[model samples]
Target: WSEPRVWPLPNVWLGVSTENQKWADVRIPILLDTPAAVRFISAEPLLGPIDLWNVNGINAIEPDWIGGPTAGTGCPHP
Candidate 1:
């Protein structure tokens, strides 16, 4: 048996949501390894700080877009 391979798909976008460095560190690498036309991070409700520039001591891999909820302009909160 052979390991599964991931291939880049047309018009496919992949993303992960991270509120802080912890989750970013955990999820970003996996997202980077996956094949996607575009990769992004959603920091909605940004509960804490995150540093995408340096994750897992690697100075590589960055999301195509990093977006978060703008003050009073995003999804309604309870």
Candidate 2:
């Protein structure tokens, strides 16, 4: 999907899972390389903000927009 976004909209959107070995997490770089006018990241299901050790890759994505991670936890207090 790195073949330069062909979409009419200049904005590009991506969802990155913080969990290691996930396809979305690994593919973000290639998507970032697309040269879209704008880029954003959806952190839903974030699995908690990823550790700095693995943050370098995410920085490269340079997301233009950000979203809160979807809470995986269910209702509290049984």
RMSD of each: 8.5, 9.2
In model 2, where is the ten-residue run with the lowest total lDDT? Answer: 57-66
lDDT of 2 by residue, 1-78 (tens): 678856635554443443323645576676566555454444434344333244332433321223445444321222
Candidate 2 whole-model C-alpha lDDT, 0 to 1 = 0.43
TM-score between candidate 1 and the true structure: 0.59
Instruction: Summarize candidate 1's per-residue lDDT along 1-78 as a digit string, tens digits.
Output: 397655676567787877667887898888888767677777655556676545432323332233544443422243
Candidate 2 residue runs with Cα over 4 Å from true position:
1-25, 51-78
lDDT of each: 0.61, 0.43
Candidate 2 matches the true fold with a TM-score of 0.37
Which residue pairs of candidate 2 clash?
39-64, 45-70
lDDT of 1: 0.61
Q: Estimate each model's TM-score.
A: 0.59, 0.37
